[model samples]
Target chain A: MSSLIVASIYQQVINDVIHNIQRDFEDSGVDVSVLNELQQLWETKIIQSRVTNFPPEDDKNQLEQEEDMENSSKRGTNKQKAKARSKSYNQNLSVGNINQDESEDELSDANSVVSNKYPENETKFTGQSAASLASIINTSNTNNMSANTGYPLSPSQRKNNAFEEDYDDQNSSTDDESQNQPLSTRAPQFLASGVNAPLASMSPMMGQRNLDQAQQNSSKINDLLNNNATGNDYMYQSLGSNSLANNNSQDTKKPYLPQNDGCDDPISVWKIFLAERKLKQLNSANKLDSTEQNKDFNMTISQVDGDNSENGGDITEHMVLCQYDKVSRTKNKWKCVLKDGIMLVNGRNYLFHKANGDFEW
Target chain B: MSQYYELYRTSTLGFALTDSLDELIQAGHITPQLAIRVLMQYDKSIAEALTNHVKARATIKGSLKTYRFCDDVWTFIISNPNFKFENEVVSADKVKIVACNARRPDEA
Candidate 1:
């Protein structure tokens, strides 16, 4: 007996990442071709994750995603692309910059090009080079992103998990009584059958401490001290093209974990979503506190207006915060996304929305 | 009041297109049905006049309607890209971030 499986990343994404690698290694066309091919091979693994419906280990996906985005966003525009892409941009600047070493062609000139533009002492995050898209699709994780309650995953996490093809038969055929029952009555939805309720009316928000949010606040402070970026780095990777190799010899052991049994647990999903929300609140308060410490940082983080790169400007958006309302599109479900964020008039940063997802100009 | 307008006059950032000559004439920036191209080519003084109006402010209240654009290009300024109406602090006392992307009826 024998079996087979294959994974994929969009050909466009591979092409996009490889294209940047090509530019970075322009002087060494052979190595550029080799690395481009390597990135393509890696992308096949990503497509596999999507098929398996499990996330990849976070860090690798994050890095590939970041690099892929930086390359893509600056693409098409010839003169207006990032100056920092050239080896010369970082040549004069800070020490121990990881991007410097990867930029191999001009290592000798690096000694003289120290830059004061990017403040020294910046702390940076590194993620795994992702081979699969599913690994990077978690509701809260992004390479350049700080958890924003503002913009949301369009086909959100719950929807992705709940609608997996395998679960359709089992879930759709629930007894009529259960189908018609109001959502609140069931306390054990996503909980696997035989898993008992922890407690009714239990305050899920009360017990756990959000250590990650606290840490993110401190890291942001570290980022300001080290570099000028106050969180304008948020982006999604662009799609590129490449050819993947044979996966017949690849290892495909799945990490042991609970599968979605779907007995029905709204609290679990809601709590997971709110984990980032709580983090956002903490980060906002902490940002306010830090703004008192440094106005420059606040301005840097929140200055998201009127700079269209199409206008031949070098400015990057520092931040453009949005908050979408909860809108019901399906049974007892709402899409929480940022385009839903109502905008304010009078050039004011305010919006008024109701519980029913209505908005007034 | 004149001084306030001076402070907030029609700088490059405050440039916008008006849909009607009636509105422009009503605001006294132009006469009825006059060609916009003629008005645009001739209105270097409007900014100067508006600046004089802006400098008269005692407090930052009652804003006049004007189009603030990223550039002088019409499409770049008016294309409804999402904007965050971030309120910056002149003094560090009142700073906040909010989503703001609407034009008042007059400006629209």
Candidate 2:
């Protein structure tokens, strides 16, 4: 009785899907025979899995007819009727699967077009910055030369020119320094440049021979330089601490080395370090190889486990898919009202309209 | 639009249909999009057929090992479960129950 019900439920599902997707198949320009083939393949697979005993072929036709009547009775809703009409109209002008590929290609082309704009915009932005920097430098140089030759420039004007030159120097030095340090180390340099900008402007005031102001500015510059030095020291300290941790680990492992044989010679110590590094590399490589082999072994085991049952595995096999009408629990006892469920138990499939489950946790 | 849950796709029947659809796709007899539409139809049809056609009722008793309620889905792992139908009783060492809410998402 259970097998028969399951078989009939499966039959109904397959028939309903096939009937519903006829328009989709037509629109896709796939031959109707392919859909028939899919149906046959699906049925054969289900039978092979032996989830349930299907009725004889003659009985199948009777079951299908009965299901068809039931479906027809329930499928008279206006929404589906409207959908059917629309599908019929679309069938006349359906462009088929070829158009689908073309549409995908067009979508990719659009994405590529959008992606191509990004690099061009980045280049334009960089070019504008470079041009503006060059202009600033040129104007400052011309103004300084004109002031020196024609007349004495005001302190503020000299200060502005000095600040510009300092900024240009910082920019060029930073570009060069960037090549030697990681990006994280550049943060302190930017802070240093920001602190130096105002002090750099004051340097020209010292050149004007205001003795007291010159001394004050020099002291301020010294303090700023000290602060900049501390910032750099902190950055370097973080990097050094990381390296120190690594060295400590290496030192702990160093006892394994032959300490009695030429341990005092610098060359011997360097050679030992090189050999240890090579051994570590080889060990890591071997570990990676073993991990890969383990992965392959696991894959084979899982594949064998999957082959043990055609229904994927025990997890998928002994499972239930259902809707819960009501689920309530009190203390350790649990109860549920499950409806419209498909239960795969002990390699056999069962269909139930409603299931009452009482369990203790 | 009424949408059906894809929870049943892990069932043997749905798995077989998906395997066959995959084969059709691999053979270039049908596109992936068409296969997806077929699956969508399958979801709707199966949900409807199970609700309207089958009338079998079952009573199950077990010791629940683990129970979880997440995202409106109730999952229960039961040990030594016994399922009793009209005249037949099926027993399994362990069974997993994955139950979605009866009320549709849109309805909720």
- Predicted model with the maximum DockQ: 2
lDDT of 2 at A208: 24
Tens digit of per-residue lDDT, candidate 1, span B1-108: 121111111111111111111111111111111222222322323322222221211111111111222322211111122222223211112222122222222344
User: A26 in model 1: Cα distance from truth in Å?
Assistant: 43
Question: What residue runs in model 2 are displaced by over 4 Å at the alpha carbon?
Answer: A53-316
Interface RMSD of each: 25.9, 22.1
Candidate 1 residues A1-361, lDDT tens each?
Answer: 0001001122332344344434433432122322422332233233222321124223334544555566533121211221222233234222111121121111111211111111110001111111022123322332122211111111111111111211222223222322343221111122211211121112233123122223333432221111111111110000011111111001001111222234223222323433333333334334444533353433333334434222212111122122222222354232222221112122221221211211111
RMSD of each: 26.2, 29.7
lDDT of each: 0.22, 0.48
For model 2, report DockQ.
0.25
True contacts kept of each: 0.04, 0.64
Error of 1 at B44 (Å): 32
Chain B of candidate 2 vs. true chain B, TM: 0.96
Window of ten residues with lowest summed lDDT in model 1 chain A: A232-241
Docking class of 1: incorrect
